[model samples]
Target chain A: MKQFFIFVKKEFFHIWRDRRTLLILFGMPIMQVMIFGFALTNEVKNSKIGILDLSKDEATAKLSERISASQYFDLVENLKSSSDIDASFRKGDTKMVIIFPEHFRESLLHSNSVQVQLIADASDPNTATTLINYASAIINDYQDELMGETKLPYTITTQTRMLYNPQQKGAYNFVPGVMAMILMLVCTMMTSIAIVKEKETGTMEVLLVSPLKPIMVILAKAVPYLLLSIVNIISILLLSVYVLDVPIAGSLALLMFTSILFIITSLSLGLLISSFTASQQTAMLISLMGLFMPTLLFSGFMFPIENMPIPMQVISNLVPAKWYYYIVKSVMIKGLGIEAIWREVLILTGMTVFLLTVSIKKYNVRLA
Target chain B: MTDEKVITAKALTKKFADFIAVNAISFEVSKGEIFGFLGANGAGKTTAMRMLCGLSLPTSGEATVAGFDVYKESEKIKKNIGYMSQKFSLYEDLTVKENMRFYGGIYGLTEKRIKEKSQQVLADLHMEAEQNKLVKSLPLGWKQKLAFSVAIFHEPAIVFLDEPTGGVDPVTRREFWEMIYQAAQNGTTVFVTTHYMDEAEYCNRVSIMVDGRIEALDTPTNLKKQFNTASMDEVFLQLARKAVRQAD
Candidate 1:
């Protein structure tokens, strides 16, 4: 244990002394996080929606069918009570909610007046805004049909309300996306370079021949990167909340827990890359070309995964960053708890475990 | 120097698939002896050194370092031996003192010991004024000498050098041998592999490997008499002519 600390300290010194590595380790994450959070735009399709129909009338059913039949919306669930609106949003079961009055058909016949409400979780303002527009258009089409013969016009006033994000800030959607991309890029590229630097300079052979345990050597090498990645996470989160003005609506502790898990997954991927690469350049190249593109493309950060081809959609499931992006978005934007993001958390954990197993198997701790 | 053996091997072998890299080679090194391992490129000198250093597993036969079996007690063997390679060793980005303290610390030395030993190492090299400089800023000769000094800093029972002085001035190489002689006199067994025949003349006993086997091993004078040559170079050439493995 004493030796392990000493080794970790040495590893830290290596990181501190090299200017280029120091820049990539600390500078790149902060720059990318800020750049991406403020400037990136988001677009999404196939957003799931829920319907709360107190009347259960033919008119309510027909509107729900019209919304679901469109390519932009997927009617996923029926909310049994008004209370279920918050629960459905928190569980990520729906992106938007449509509520009908108790006697929609009766009220229209008696007074030629009724009301309909569309509530959206505006943490993702683009998707929320688009869904509201689509649903309002459908309700207006229904209202136009009823106005064909009546002089009163039987008005259906559509009201749209945003939950969680009242101001509909743009940071809500892409902050989590930026966090996933930065973590994946910085953690992976830094660690693989650190490990491969030893191999390139021949320090690894010296370390391997020492009395220190090979496992200890590997752990010592990874510990510094892990801690630095945590620091990056804290910086990104602070910037999002303070500078970008996006609040953490879920449990802060759970948010950190999931971020650390994702960091470990990226570090293990770095280790696997180091095992196959003999030079620091190769490690850095693989980290960039292999990890960065997939993360940006498949994590739904830069491109909407839903709008992709079927083969791409299937392939996106294998990207670890995709799940991490989902977890962060659910926790930070939708204000969801572990009950909603637990499956994503589990998937990240499983990827970390598998990556660690394969990397340890491939990593040559000896000179052979 | 006592005659107690610090390393023993009995037909230790290593095979890479169909190729036999080290085939049933056996040797022993007594304490305080400067044993030179001489070979042409691809002659399996490094493969044998790796097995003895507890870095590679032998396919057959047996070996021991510092009274511990190479197979079952490699960790212990590593604790008892120091290794240096010609390709590279110390962290170039770290200061000379930092590199010393780092290696010393990982060897389980205390803070005070690391400080004191680092000071002593710097003073011995007449480099006390340059201790704070990064190793990359130093010249190649000084770096090699510092690497050799740091490798044996833990006072391990045996120090293994895989061509420690590959490219350097002849004067610096001579100075490097003086350091090895001083260490051997202080009761540390030195096991070195080298391409320089003159360096082999300085070893107390030299082993010539050709094609995965030790073709000849004896005192320099004895080897000269056995090979019927005037110097170690002709002795190497006469034996190396038998090698069939192509050098990379």
Candidate 2:
């Protein structure tokens, strides 16, 4: 235990003395969270639309007014003819073109029917789909207001409360995910590469031949990273709450407990990688390719796991980060406790144990 | 003095898959003696040293280091031994004092002992003026000397130097040998491996390894007389040629 503390002190000196590593450990998460929060948003607002008002009637004018008033669409261009529709889309200014057929109001009133053409730019499929849905919903609402007495046969209403984030703030989701990813990256990859660096510099042999126990040496290396990762978690939480206005719906203590658990899982994975690789470059490549990519890609940080293929979903179940991501989202966004996310917590704990056991076993085998 | 050898090995072998890196080699080194392990590149000197240092497992033979069985009490033996590799293994980013403190600390030295020993080691090496500088900024000779000092900073029973003076100038190497002599005088057994045949002359007893086995083990005078050569270098060259000829 005394040797372990001394080794931990050395590890802390290494971390505190390296400026560049310090930056990557703390600065990266804040930068990533702020960038992903403010710059990249899914909410579609002020989308430009080209209008071809062939009817030039009161009803058509009322519909256009409603579409412009609804914050989703902006009237950017008045196309003189149908031929201009394709040109407007190609120029990229107009995301959609609304065409009103000739005698549209007359047909709707006298024949109880009218046809309107809604052309959308499908270059970006997600934005296009959102735009179409917004336009459709607004038009349907206007139709309901016009025909107040007509009762629809079937209707479904979705009241999306978005509990913790009432406005569906992107930061509330991204802050937690970024925190998970950055913590994993810093703790696991940095620790693994640092160990491999000792090998590269030939310091590992010196340490092994010393009075220090191998297990104590590994713990010494991991403790500083574990502490730093906790600091990173706190910074991210503070940034999310204060700057991003993303509340911590669950207990702070629980969130911290889960974060520490995940940090251990990540650190153990790093140690496992370091045990297999001889060089810092190899350790880094393996950590990034094997751990970071899977953590970021399959852990539901950028993409929803439910939308992934079946095989990928099965593979994601093996990634410790996946469970941790779920745990963070549950505790932070859903305000769920251990009872609500016990399975995810259990998976993370199991992964931590399995990885740490494997790494320790491998280290012993190498020593032998 | 204790009537027990500090190091003893019988047919100690290390094999990697099909290749026998250290093949059935045997030797012994008494306590408080500067024992030199000599071989050319890939002659299995390092492999044997690693086994003695408890860093590698011997495949098919028995060995003991610091009176502890190599296989069973490897960790205990490690605690009793210190090692300095060919590479200057000190953390270059740390100051000289910091490096000493770190190595001493991890070896379970108390804070007071670390401070006192570091001061003594630095003063002994005449490096007290540069203790605050990062090790990377130190001269190669100084760094090598400091590495040696740090390896034995915990005052282990044995210190293993794997080519401790590999790249230093002859003058510095002599001065470094003085430090090793000092360590031996203080009753620390020195087990060193070197390619420089001239260095083998400085050992109390030297062993020549050729192709994973010790070909000759004796005092420098005995080896010279046995090989009918004027110096240890000539003895090594003749033995190396004879080994190559036999292989051919």
Candidate 3:
């Protein structure tokens, strides 16, 4: 509509005129991608590795306990059989699958040796290799302790099998996380603050009193943000692929489609925050505290969700950013298709719809 | 013209939970009269105006603006009315011309009409040379005038001004009243709410609200005579002291 265009044009003027906004919109995404991609991480903590204990003996039980107890890895899934490891790896749920052969205690006592196979989901080669080394060292320590006491000779072997990411580039992990964080900051935080600024300046009343419908006003406000978020996505993708050398394994179209859903989810969240806040300062604080902290702490962008406490893992389910991070990981790093990520897409879409509905209901044309 | 009422209300009310913001009250305004809405800080002047402007729903009662029902035909009412708030509502980041262009565009003004009207308004304000300047750079008086002009740019049947001259000098306020008088002379009804008692003298009729109800409604001369006061200020003080609710 002509009125919608006029509203959008006015919004553009507001955004363009503010230098701080221009800096935040364009500067922050690139800086976040480059800084997080190249600089932040090397130590792997809370790697989700599955454990399959074929021998229900004291030794394997002790081994599982010690592996999980170690600071480096969190034993996320306990597999029933060898058949489940491949599916778990493809799901990107588990980084490594440690399997103990049947009759390991008997075989170790009878032949002085036992075989243990370590299957690493090489999608993140760095993490996979580190997990294998940690597991191997733990086993060697246990074997050495046995040798220290008894005169009998015994040996344990660790076989490492790497999966999707053969190169173990650290950029793989950082790329997905940076994308999620930057999109969330730009879309959610920025939109909330912008809308609240109108409320602060008292221009929102004038807008509401205009002939333009409230829904149309909200749509026009969101359009510029949607376009800006897309631009941010493209810029992050370029930096990740070209500068950081992170590969895009899946279809770029599908990646973009998923990003659009995530952006909408974030925008709805921002609108919801704006509706609750009376001023720009309150909106900014709530967005940073509500969105930024949770996305950073619980979304598995900075830390693995499986490694978090049970309550935290449950809470992370409510954050749209967690699902977006998983989707990015599956499509970009694991090279998985839509069939593998349909549930995440559904969740993001559902969150978007729910947030948008609540915000629309909450957005009052009347001044409080 | 007095027989042709533009705004008619009967027992209009608004309640927020247990608290009644605007208790049952009613009044009527002529088609081209300047109606001054005066009240203490928490006297519910804004609440009543909000309901009438189609921005809020009343808990009970019926009202019509510009011949359209306030409840069901709010969109129609919106198209026929204009509003300006206490905080001057111009986009400070935008140039003077752009602000006019934007308001004109949203009010359904055609491109040529917008250009011509923008020019005419700028010339009328003697601000044609300052059209390209950002509104924030202008003085408070100019911003207030520009905001008022934009509100009635569409020539709505009624224009509601909420404390339009709050922080301006007396000379500017006088000039601003001249503009309102000119608009009313051209057959545009003005419904304005202000804290300043002197501005009430400029209105054709004035209503003073106290504690969610209109305590007095009459011409400024009659209000002064009835209260046994020499000035509108003394008359306001005598009525305002009876307020049951504290200023919010």
Candidate 4:
């Protein structure tokens, strides 16, 4: 126990001595969280749209007023002619344009049908889809109110209800994903780089030659990162809950335990990388290119695995972060227990064991 | 007195696939002696030292360090030995006193013992005033000396130094030898490896390795007389040339 404390103290000294590394470790996570939370949002609001209302009638005027009043469209301009639509969109001021035909009110009143065109810029597919859906919903609601008195046969009304994330706040999804990502980055990548740094600096030889066993040295190096990862997990959870209003609906203790398990798995993977690479730079590149990208892209963090291409969907199963993300989402969002996420938990456990075994084997072989 | 051999190796060999780093060789060093393992770069000096320190395993040999079997009792051997590398293995960010305390602590020394020994070690090196300063702030010579002192702080049975004085001034190297002599006087065996032929003269006895084999094993004076050379460097050159001729 005394030896362990001494080792942990040495690890803390290494961290405290490197001020720049400490800053990058703590600051990057919060910065990424705030940036992803606020800057990149899925909810469409105040989207600028141009209206070309050719019909000088009460119906067209009312429809224009409704479009302008809705929060989704800002009604940036009212163009005079169809040629003006091209110029306005070219300026990039409007994301979409609504065109009303000349006999729109007459056609609607006499024949109960009118043609209106909604043109959306498809450069950003997600934003374009959101704007079109918002506009369509407002128009549909208006038509339903207008024809309230007329009873029609085979009338169908659709009520959409979102489960778990009712508000569809991006923070709800990102807070959990960011927590997993940051933990993996700090615990796994940093630990691997630290070990490789020792190798590069030749300090690893000194430690190995000392009276300390190789396994004990590795354990000592990992203990501080494990503790720091736990602390980061708590900080992220607190920030998400208090600052962003993202709740942990399940038991906090269970979430903490599972997060620790994932952090250990990440650290084990880092050790494996360190064992393979002789230089810190190589270890860092491997961790980032080989681990970080896959964790971010295929771990169900940004893109849903179910919606991915078949090969990519298959690759997602190989990333440990995918299992961790599933566990966190299940516990935090769905309020589920170990019984619900036991499969993911078991997979993570198995990966941790496999990585740790391989690293130990490699380390022994190198020593021999 | 027959049991005074601190290290014993018989037909010790280490090979990495087809490359024989340290071929089958045997040697022994008595307790309280400064034994120098001399060689050029890639001459298997480091490979042999690593095996003796229990950091690496011998391929096919029987070796014991400080009365512990190298194969089955490496951990016991480690606990009885101290190691200082050519890299000057001390934490640069830590203070002199902190480095000593840390190593002592890791070796399972009590806090009181660490404090007492750290003070004594610092005082012995005339570095009492510099204890609070970070190691990185010190001169290279002082760091090397401090690293050597810290490695043997626990007064282990044997301290293995893999070229402990690689890039230091001659004056500091001389002072470092004095410390090694003091440790030897205190009944601690010193097993050191070095490329500097002059530094090998400071050892009680030295072994010259060429082409992964020990070409000469004797005192510096005896080696010079045996090879009919003026200095250890000329003796080493002659042996290396002879080995090359044999290989051709």
Index of the highest-DockQ prediction: 4
User: What TM-score does candidate 3 reach?
Assistant: 0.81
Candidate 1 yields a Cα-based lDDT of: 0.87
Q: Local error of candidate 1 at B90, Å?
A: 1.0
- Give the CAPRI class of candidate 3: medium
lDDT of 4: 0.83
Residue A334 of model 1 has an lDDT of: 82
User: Would you estimate the TM-scores of all the predictions?
Assistant: 0.81, 0.82, 0.81, 0.83
Interface RMSD for each predicted structure: 1.6, 1.2, 2.0, 1.2
Q: Write the per-residue lDDT of candidate 1 for residues A225-315, one digit (tens) a residue.
A: 8898889889888887888667999988999999999999998998889888999889988998888899988888766787788999999
Q: How large is the C-alpha RMSD of every model relative to the true structure? A: 10.0, 6.1, 10.6, 5.7
The best candidate in terms of lDDT: 3
Candidate 1 C-alpha error for residue A358, in Å? 1.3
Please give the CA lDDT of all the candidate structures. 0.87, 0.83, 0.88, 0.83
Off by over 4 Å in 3: A40-172, A364-368
DockQ of 2: 0.65
Error of 4 at B45 (Å): 1.4
Q: Which tens-of-lDDT digit does each residue in B205-239 have in candidate 1?
A: 99898989999989999999998889999999999
Interface root-mean-square deviation, candidate 4: 1.2
Pairwise DockQ winner, candidates 2 and 4: 4
- Model 4 shows how many backbone clashes? 0
